[model samples]
Target: YHLAREKKGMSLRPPYRQPHHLASAISLIGGGTYPKPGEISLAHRGVLFLDELGEFSRKTLDMLRQPMESGEVTISRVKQTVTYPSSFTLIAATNPCPCGYYGSRERYCTCTPRQVTDYQLKVSGPILDRLDFVLSLKSSGLQEKAASETSAEIRHRIGCVRSLQHERYGSHSLNATVSYQQLERTAGFSEVQLQRIGIVCFEQKWSNRTQVKLLRLARTIADLQGSETMTDSAIQEAIEWRKLPNVLQGGEHLGPT
Candidate 1:
């Protein structure tokens, strides 16, 4: 409804919802005797929520890469090729491990190292890299409760930040949604900062795509803070977010972004 209002007169981009039970590349790609359209294609200009993300077949999940990267899904038959829009926000969730207690402090992991590896391996590196944000949630006990901002307060702040982004980009979207060229112009990083990022990328064997993603995330952090400049701290925070999965796998430090 919001998108329709925003894009008046434009074709309605119907949101696609594919349950976890329909976990198959064929299902996603519309494979059958008379193959139809796919979920990714159907989810154009909307959201694709994949619950129990790790349980999805590796091949099925792998099929997401092309559409995610290219923003279109192509289905080829004997006679013709059909293309569909796939510009959608991909949201997913999964357990930390097979036992769902890999990093839990209150509970012990019942799964073996092999089991953990197998589970992690289900979500491929390429797919993981495509994700813009990777957040880890740990259960907080009641004793840890303290005075914190409410959802309304958080939403208000978000609205302010979004307004700032709109003024900056001349659009009602975020830096994350901006193109690489736009990013290069608006979120330009300093030589020193780029050098620092280069050092980490080289050491960690991070791909160029990941490096750009880190910069984009850092830009968003800066925008949220109402900062005209992307400070070193903001860049560091973005880098840390990108490094979180590694930290979960036993890497140390994992300092502030």
Candidate 2:
């Protein structure tokens, strides 16, 4: 029984696991009388998408922090100890509030301020800090437009960018995973841009981790534009993209300086 799992293993062609919001800690993190791999491990070298992110228990979510940072999860039992690779890309989606209509122009929010605060706080600060960027999206009706770049063309452009990054930081390195010092040395931020970032960070009271993430995002934006050096527009765009609404503590708006 379960022979296919035992022999062939759970690696799909680019494995993608979307665990339900009701998934238990044991199911997601892999723990039982006899321990085995979990969704994070099953998604190795692939993706772990958490939809309706706020619906998961905070404890279950926090359990992801260690494995996410270490790229592996260790389970120790009386009979055996197991380590599983968990190097999967994490993509989570959540609503702006409990009723999911907060800030919507077409619909009025049904949630009270306290309820909204509680819902937003489900995803804790540590998780937010670890995230590279947070984007808030609003639904819009589709309209006719001119032809844009095809998927093939976009892929080719991305491939070229990857090659450029590889040349800069060896075969295995990309802007997201590179060390701070290495990136900073060649990030190409001018003196004025650096000073502006410093001032903004101070004003916003951003954590050291957040500041570094901003730089990494800016660096990638520059790379995407085929720019050898970071530009003011790139830095500003990164700032806007990375701006986290102050929802954790119940703020009604985001004044992303």
lDDT of 2 by residue, 146-173 (tens): 4589889998999898888888986578
Cα lDDT computed for each candidate against the true fold: 0.73, 0.78
- The TM-score, computed over Cα atoms with residue i paired to residue i, of candidate 2 is 0.85
Alpha-carbon lDDT of model 2: 0.78
Model 2: residues with Cα > 4 Å off, grouped in runs: 1-12, 142-147, 247-257
Candidate 1, superposed: residue stretches over 4 Å from native: 1-18, 31-35, 142-147, 171-173, 249-257
Q: What is the TM-score of each candidate against the true structure?
A: 0.81, 0.85
**Deviation from native of the Cα of residue 142 in model 2, angstroms:** 4.2
Clashes of each: 2, 0
Residue-wise C-alpha lDDT for candidate 1, range 1-257, written one tens digit per residue = 23112233445655856566456786665545455556665567777778777778888888888888888877787877666677777877778676788867677889998998898788888888888767676666699977698989988998888788788789865776778887777776888998998898888898999888888888888877778887999988988888776655411111111
Q: What is the lDDT of candidate 1?
A: 0.73
Candidate 2 lDDT at 112 equals 98
Task: Give the range where candidate 1 is weakest over 10 consecutive residues by summed lDDT.
Answer: 248-257
